[model samples]
Target: MKAVETAPHEYMANYVYSNSGLGAWFGAARLVDATGSKRGSFRLNGETWRVTLSYQESGLAPPEGGETPDGTRVDFDTLREFRLNAVVDDEIGERKVKALIQPRWYGLESESGKSVARPMWELGDAVNVRVNASNVEFDTVETAIQRAAGAVTLDPMYFDDRNEEYSVVMDAARYVRLDRDVSGPVHAREGPIARMGHLLESDRSGYRKIVQDDTERVGYYHTVTLGPKRVRECFPDHRIPKEFKHYYARNAESLPDDHPLAHPKVEASYQGSRWDETLRPVDHDELADELEEAVLATINEAGLPTQPLDDDGLGGGRTYVEDAYFEAKTVDRSRVLPLNLERVESDQRNVVVRQLANGLSPVEWDSLKTLVADGGDVSPAEIADEHDWHPDSVRRGLRRIEDMVVREQGSVALRSHYVAEQVVEALDAAREGVRNAMGTAANAVQNAERRSLDERTDELIAFCQSNGIHIDEREAQLRVRMGNLTGESWSELVTRLKRFWTAAGRDPERLKESVTHYRDEAGPKIRQARGAWTGGQTLQ
Candidate 1:
């Protein structure tokens, strides 16, 4: 059968052409009815001509054996094809053109099972093709198709939402290289899908969902490009909120048991128990209310402010109790004393008695009390003499009593100051007593010396009479010498008197001479006695 070609432009509109510089088509169309329609005339170099085209059988079939030939019509069983013939009359002789026109390309198939034609470009080799005015080298037609179909063009402003007025041109090749699934509807509005697309191109992990206008189907979502396998680790199932457990449980059931989202192992006993004996559920609100009530009760018992204190409240907004703080005062007669008066008196007496007993002997104690009672008029010396104690010991005992009184009474006793004053007065009186005793002792020593001297004088007088030395002046001279030799022995007194008499010319010879010279002037018997005493002769 022959079909005449008429509207070539109309026929070419229904098929997709390649950029291989080879005339071809890749899609199905009814071209037999389009051949006879008047569309336009062909013009070459300003020469006009009516173009007449027709087709005839080419009588070629696809190979049936080991390998198929290139450019073979494999879509049909019989390979019913045609040779296209074109004639154009000009000033030269008539010219004829011939070319084959098969029903379709050998391997191309449309969705409706119609044969299609495509450029016979090198299929398995690498080829450089232009897309968006830029050359892109692809290894195969499949790669080229994927590059064109999977490419997602986006405005740079979509990712940078902060700057609305800014615009940037992005290379589609860069996005295609990321291998993101960009087959969904990319809306220009600033929505999740748009953001997701932007994230995918930027090598980010994200997801998006959309509801069609007529369908209410939910729970469907798509995960967009995650940069790499490592990038998918960032979006793990554990990060999902626990509140979404119900939905996740449903989803998990659909997954394999080994999947991460699958339900974990549960204790069989726990699952079987309807009402657990060991565990009880508590209402948190009731517990909170009970705790609050207990706290308020405690606060009220403590006498503290229960409500929040205002700025002008008592204690200047500080929590405080009523009459809770106080200062302690020293104990005095003005304060109320305990009713046990006897016990108090006994304790005071015990302290004073213990101090007195520990510090003094019985005699010393009695004497000290007497001295205090006597208004300190009794001397320590008198007390020592009566007690057979040393006077210094008596004074020490009295001083001890004064110290004990001060220590036992502290500042409370009326005797404390008096005792201090008495101690000072006692020291003064004791010193005066010591001086008086020293003077009395000196007088007694002087008197004893005078008696000894008087005795020695009598002895000397008797010795002179016994020796027949009857010098009447001898007694007076001995008395004077004895007075000068006070505290000396009687023998020393006598020796000193002898030396005095010898130096005074009272020797035997000197006395006899003196007696003769004064015979007429002196008594004769006195001169004879003196002579006998000096000459070692007995008195007559």
Candidate 2:
């Protein structure tokens, strides 16, 4: 089934329709006779042919022995079928499958000499072409192609000398598949296809938009889609001016008499299916070569400037983070500090340092704090023993910010006095914030002890509601009655509440009522919870 060519070569050679996009659907229904249709009849060269549409479905194969002639496989779970039939007689009611059609792109050749002047013909209108035959014989294909080529041409969409709005899809001798992880510039400013940026980019594929000029209200827009095996360029929402349209269009009457379309041509000549990897070159070196030739020929015939991708498949400039990382791995490591710390603005530098500080484990932070306080180089073993941590834990913590620290022999020290000052300042501020928070919580717990049970219950309920932690009135009352607020510090109480909330799948982080922000909201609630916890009532 996979090997069968679904449609006859004669039908393809004789037909003057596209094998992809809207043309595929139209061609299948009409000349190829692959799709069913409303009962109708059309006359071509004195032969009246009746048309009908029928549909079928199959699993993992073509329906009723049908196959995809383009050599692409159907999806694993399903296959589609659309068959065309010709009604022979009304009285006898006999019908026959006219021919099977599998839409295979045959490039820009025509068995018939004619080309569609107005490509946007309505489906009903398109079926009423002046030429047709009992079968797709050479003379029949030629008549249809010639008559259509000789027919009236379409007016341009815009009444302007500049034909900026022309769209075409052409097959190229080469394919483009971008590798995102290969480092380099993803786009270039100067090229035939200029100012290109990717709408979507990934390791294996990308969709890039090329805007030729920014100032023009209406400018040429082009896109190149890259896949593992195929690269297709599309210029949509456009049309060539009448003077130049003849070259790209199927019609060849205006060309020199010796031109292929002007004389004899095979529709599938020099054509290879984009879907069939074996038929066409899988990878075009870059958008700069044959791929560019196809595009440049289409748009002032078009082109792009591209660089070789790096090992990662990401193109363009290396991110500063990656720069610092690569530098850090070197023996000299001279550029690592400036790349990370000196190049960015003050605020950004602080952000980078703060992120580094935040990434350290609590033990790491403690070790750093101790070192900062000591104001000297410290051994990992010494720091670990002071904090009752394993030596490896201390070393690991220091390594998280190793770029900012100098490790020589067995001792680790901040890389510079300035970096030491910054680390100390950041660490001190974080500790102060925590201390202030704990103080507020401790004060709230003390204050709750003075309030009546009813007053405390009201405060707890209001705090929960305001903070987005939902609790019913009954549950609040039960919590106040059951809980005791003795012995636990503010941090311990907050921990207990967070644990229960986490267990219940509620995020404590979303709570707006922080100890510092909602001074009155948390203290009493903490007290009520503590008392209720002792009384064995769960805080809902």
lDDT of each prediction vs. the true structure? 0.27, 0.32
Candidate No. with top lDDT: 2
| Sliding window of 10 residues with minimal summed lDDT for model 1 | 4-13
The runs of at least 3 residues in candidate 1 whose Cα sits more than 4 Å from the true structure, single-residue gaps closed, are: 1-29, 33-40, 62-86, 91-98, 102-540
- Put down candidate 2 lDDT per residue, 20-81, tens digits, no spaces: 32232333334323323334554455544455544444122221223233333323233333
Candidate 2 achieves a global lDDT of 0.32
Best by TM-score: 2
At residue 472, candidate 2 shows an lDDT of 20
lDDT of 1: 0.27
List clash counts for every candidate, in order.
Answer: 4, 36
lDDT of 1 by residue, 217-316 (tens): 1212222222222112222211110000001223544666444334211000011021111111122122222222322322222233334333343333
Query: All predictions: root-mean-square deviation over Cα?
Result: 58.3, 25.1
| Candidate 2 off by > 4 Å | 1-357, 434-540
